[model samples]
Target: MRILILTHRVPFPQNGGYPIVVGNTIKGLVSMGHEVSLISINVKKHSGRQHERDDLLNKISYTEYGIDTHISVLEVFSNLFTRNPYNINKYYDAGFEKLVLQNIKDNHYDVVQLEGLFVGPYVAAIRKNTTAKLIYRAHNIEHQVWHRLAHQKNDPFKKWYLNLLARRVKKYELELLNQFDGIAVFTGEDKNAMESFGAEIPLCVVPIGVDMGKYQPEPDKTECPSLFFLGSLDWLPNREGIEWFIENFHKEIVDGDLKVKFYVAGNSIPEDFDEYDVPDKVFIQGEVDDALEFVNSKSIMIVPLLSGGGMRVKIVEGMAMKKCIISTTIGAEGINFAHGDNIIIANNAGEFYDALKRCIADEWYCREIGENARKLVEQEHDVNKVTRDLVAFYQSVI
Candidate 1:
C-alpha cells in the first residue's frame, strides 16, 4: 500500500502531542510494509530543529513548506469579517495548496491522509487532482474544543469571539464529512459524535498508541509522594487548567501539612506565568532532556484539562510507564479505563485535592492503580497492534 500523510506541523522531535501522534502513525504504517510519504508545514517554532528520524528519514520521502503561525492583532481583527473559521483560515497557504496538488499529480498514492482538521482545506485540491482515497483523521471534534473553551471564558469579548469561531468550525467540519471517502477518529466517542452530526461515511476508531517496549516503568528512579503535570504550557487548555489549579487548590494543599511536592515540566512556559506563591513546592521545570525519563521519575501525573478534545498522548504514555494518573473527565475523554481501576477522575478543585491526599496516604492503593494502568496500555495500545489494526481498516476502506 502507498500512502501520503499531510500535517499542519512537522512531526519530528515528537516533543508535543500532535507530533507524537503523527510520528508514531507514520512509523507504524512503514513498519507494516507500506510505502509512506509525508508533506508537512514548517512553522517558526520547529524551524531550527533537526528533522532526523533514523528509522523513517532514510526510508520515506518528505517535504516541508514554511508558513507563518503567529497570532497578531491584525489577523484577529481580519478574522472578524471572514466567514471561514479563524483557526482554519490562519493555516491555509496558497503555496501549500499548490504543493499538495502537485504532489498528488506527480506521484499517485493509494490513500492521502489529512492529519487533522487544519489540513482539511486541501481536500478539494486532492479530490480534483488525484484518484487516491481521501482519509480525514479527525483528531477530535474540532469545534467542540472551541465550544468548551467559550463556555469557560470569563471575558465578554473573548467569549463572544470563541462562540463565533466554534459555530463556524462546526459548519466547516460537517461539510467535510461527506467530502472524504472515510473518517478516522481518535476514539469511539468522537465517532459517535460525528455520526450524530450526520457523518455517514465509513469511520474507524484509531486511538493514539505508544511504543510499549520503550515505555516500561522504572520503580527505583521514581520520586514517590510527588505529583507532576507535563504538557505544552503555551497551549490555552494547559495554561488555563494550571491557573485554575493554583487559584483554587494549590495553596490549600500546600498549607494542609501534606508531604507532597508538585512539579511542572514542558516546553513554552509564558514569561508572565507566576500563579503560585511557593516556588519550592511547585517546581516549574521547563523542557526536560527526556520526556519518558522525566515521566518515570514522577509518582503521580496530573492532567487537569478544563478544555480540549481528543485523547492526550501524555496520558497514554503515562499509563504505559505505570504512573498513577489523575485527570478531569474532559481530560480522560477517550481512554477506556474505570475511574478507580486504572486511573483516577477528578473534575473540580475539591475532588482533585482529595484524590491527591488519598494517594499520599495509601501507597498500596496508588501502586495498584499504576500497575493496572500499565497492564491496560500494554494490552490495548501497543504501537504494533494499533498499526496492524489500522492497516486492516485501510484495506477495508480501499
Candidate 2:
C-alpha cells in the first residue's frame, strides 16, 4: 500500500512525541513493504538539520513549507474575534496547501493519513483532488488538553482565555469527524470521547508504537535512586508539570533530607527557569543527543503531567527501556497502565513524593516494576505488530 502522511512538523530526528509517532509509523510502514511519503510544515522548532540516511525518503523527498508560528500581542488581540482557534490559524501556510493539493493529484496514494487535528483543515482539498481513503490519525482529544489546562491554571485571565480556546477547539474537532473517511485514535479513551462528541465514522485505536529491537534495556542498572522527567520543554503541560513538581514535591523531598537526585532533559528550556529557586539536587540538561541513552542511564523515570492528552511517547520509551516510572493518573492516561504493576500512579504532590520514597526504599520492588513495564510494551506497543494491525484497518476502510 502507498501511504501519504500529513504532519504539522518535520517527522525526522524523532526526538519529541509528535515526531516519534510520525517517524516510527513511517519506518514501520516502509519495513512492512509499503510505500510511505510525507508532507510536513518546516516549523523551525521541529526541524532537524541535514543528516545522512539510507531511507528512500528523507526531508528532501517531502514538500516542506515554512510558516510563521509565532504569535504577537496584536495577533492575540485579533484572535479573540476569530472563529478558528489561534493554534490552528498559526499553522496556516498557503504553499503547504498548494503542495498538498498537487501531491494528492500527482501521486496515487491508497491512504492519506492526517497526523493531527491541526492538519484537518486540509481534508477538503485532499477529498476533492484524490480518491484516496482519508484517515484522521488523532493524537488526542485536543480540546480536552486545553480544558484540563484551564482548570489547572490559577490566573483568571489565562483561565478565561484557555476556556474560550477549548470551546473553539471542541467545536472544530466535532466538525472534523464527518469530514474524514476513518479515524485512528491514539487511545481507546480518545475513541470513546470522539463517539460521545457525535462521531459516527469508522474508527480504531492505533496507539503510538516503538521499535523494540532498537530500545534494548541496559544490562547493568543504576544502583542509586534518581528520578528524571524527560519531555519537550516547549510543551505547556510538561513545563507546568515540572514547575509544579519542583515547587510542591521536589523541595519537600530534598528538604526532608532524602538522598535522591532529579534530572530534567528536553529541548527549548524556557529562560524563566533560571529565576526559579531550583534545588541544587536538580540538574536541567537541555536537549541530549540520544534520548534512549539518557533514559537507560537513569534509574527511574517520571511523568508529572497535570494537563495533556494522548500517550506520552517518553513513557512508552521508558517502559521499553525497562525503567521504573512514577506518573500522575492524567499523565498515564491512554496508556492503560497498571497502578502497582507496570507503573506507579501518583495524583497529587504528596502522592508523588510517597511513590518516589517507596521506589528509593525498595530497590528490588523498583526492579520488579521495571521488568513488568518492559513486558507490557512487548505485548501491546510493539511497532511491527501495531503497523500490521493498522494495515488491516486500512484494508477494512478501503
- The lowest-lDDT stretch of 10 consecutive residues in candidate 1 is 271-280
lDDT of 1 by residue, 260-357 (tens): 88888888876555455365577777778799999999898899999999898989999988889999999998999899999999999879878988
Q: Evaluate residue 245 in candidate 2 and report its C-alpha lDDT on the 0 to 100 scale.
A: 84
Alpha carbon lDDT of residue 372, candidate 1? 97
Task: Write candidate 2's Cα lDDT for 306-397 as tens digits.
Answer: 99998889899999888999999888888878899999999897787788888978878888999999999999999998998889899999
Clashes of 2: 0
The TM-score values for the models, in the order shown, are 0.96, 0.95
Worst 10 residues of 2 by lDDT: 51-60
Could you give me the TM-score of model 2 versus the true structure? 0.95
Q: Give the TM-score of candidate 1.
A: 0.96
Residue 390, model 1: Cα distance from true site in angstroms: 1.2
The collision pairs in model 2 are none
lDDT of 1: 0.86
- Model 2 residue 312 CA deviation (Å) reads 1.3
